[model samples]
Target: MSSNFTNTYTIHMLCANKYEDILTQFSSPIEIEDLWLAALTEWCHSPTAQCNLGTNVPPNSRIACTDPWYSKLRWITLGYHYQWSERVYNESKVGEFPSLLYGTTVNIINFLKHLIEGREISSNNSSRLLEQCQNYTPEASIVNYYRTKTTMGFHSDDAEVDKEAPLVSISFGPTALFLLETSEAIKHEFDAPLHGSFDHVLPIYLHHGDVVIMAGKSRLARHAVPLIFFDDDTEVVSKGALRVSHNVCDKIVKEDHNEGVCIHCQECLTYIRTTRINMNIRQVMPVHR
Candidate 1:
């Protein structure tokens, strides 16, 4: 933990002249991705259903996602009942998580507290969030597994009773395109691409071990993932496309030259080529509050 490098990076300033600072690339010595994958397989057994958002899909569509199923993970949010809901219906108590998962959750929470105290978050909403984060004890998590073709629409996480707490997102496997936009972008009709001149969208390339803390005003900021780089367009140059890298964390291939993907992470990257895993840990305060 002491050897980690955490800092604030501003994507861009909004029209209100307020700069949104996101905590990105907060590194840690522990193999976070490995822990995430292990917990994913151990906890989330039995294939679940895909997100049925009432979108039309042709019966003969060849896309793998046309017949999609559940690829996301959760902490104590088991059972087929609350699949799409934000927080676990009956939130697990503290220390109820597996040894590895609990440790990781606490480590992240502490890191966030330190980050907020050390830096100055610009938005008033975030400043208030920092106060909640200090005393925040997370009860559940929603971990989503995604293939290259998987894409989630623009939306905000506002279900928790304690809306001030930020959403902590960790990425594992190949990089993907993450989009963040202003509240103005939340319209009745969602166009895949931003239309007109006023569409305020910022595209971010989230890579393995990359941690994004969406707190403060950024928490309410509408965001989504439109595309993922599952193929070798970015990795292969002279040679033809390479097979997916090994999935295990420690195992590394000798010939991966991607700029961001590191050798230590290649084991998981190569194996989980067309897919990614995301763990979003959050605190859901008591209902009475």
Candidate 2:
């Protein structure tokens, strides 16, 4: 749960602790933990309902498209479904998401904004990136689950129409090595080592309950999660692992668990007891009718 950054784009890392902090704080319904649990429960059950490239894929299409972990976490659209072109459609072709998911989306959006207020966002596009986030309301969320083997290629999240808004990312489970490219040049350095030239790239170790907000110039900058270290493999596993195994990790973790501390539970501990989950929430402007 270490955080580092230069004066370029502002990357705020919230909750520099393990997943146990997330489970404890978010377990209470009064603290909006129920919203996160509800969203996770709905997606795990509705395996085929995750968002895709939105071609001719039907509402019940099982095609995972580009994302292999789509079954664990799907795109839950509140107002519209996002297309491959980065635009959104008002039609509920992919069907609407649950109320709990929508509520959780809003909560994350506001939390991100609040966490990075007044922070300078290095952006040549416009100077008001942080200003825009002040009033931003996210309508779409890309929920993702990851195993030790899963690796995300370098990419920027510029699909939303409102590019001014920041991206809110929440991490759970094992620690991960996250990469951020500072240069405007788009380089797919997925194979590069964790540490790149300090001038161009910054490396971060993201742990469970760590919240990252990429706003302003950093919002559009290229980033990726190149490596994930699961708890089972690491010498020291987060205390949250015990909570997840015991079925006391709130509603979502319990629902995903089986009888006792079963290792087969995908939510509890799959992929040799090393599973990670991330929620990337963004704002998609609705097309004016």
- Provide the overall lDDT of each model, using Cα atoms, as 2-decimal numbers: 0.49, 0.50
lDDT tens digits by residue: candidate 2, 1-289: 3421111112243221101112113212222233334333445445334443333233322222223443333244433455646444444434445556556545655544443463322234333544565566656666666744678988877767677566777665577888777753334447754433544666677755556766665668777888887643432233334434443233334553444444333344343245566777766663341
In model 2, how many backbone clashes occur? Answer: 0
Candidate 2 residue spans exceeding 4 A from truth = 1-40, 46-48, 51-79, 84-94, 97-127, 184-198, 231-273, 286-289
lDDT, candidate 1, at 86? 52
Which pairs of residues have clashing backbones in candidate 2?
none
- Model 1: per-residue Cα lDDT at residue 256: 47
Clashes of each: 7, 0
- lDDT string for model 1 (77-176, tens) is 3222233545334333222434565566566667666655776444444456567567665555655666546778887776665666656676655566
Alpha-carbon error at 87 in model 2, in Å? 7.6
Which number leads on lDDT?
Answer: 2
For candidate 2, the lDDT comes to 0.50
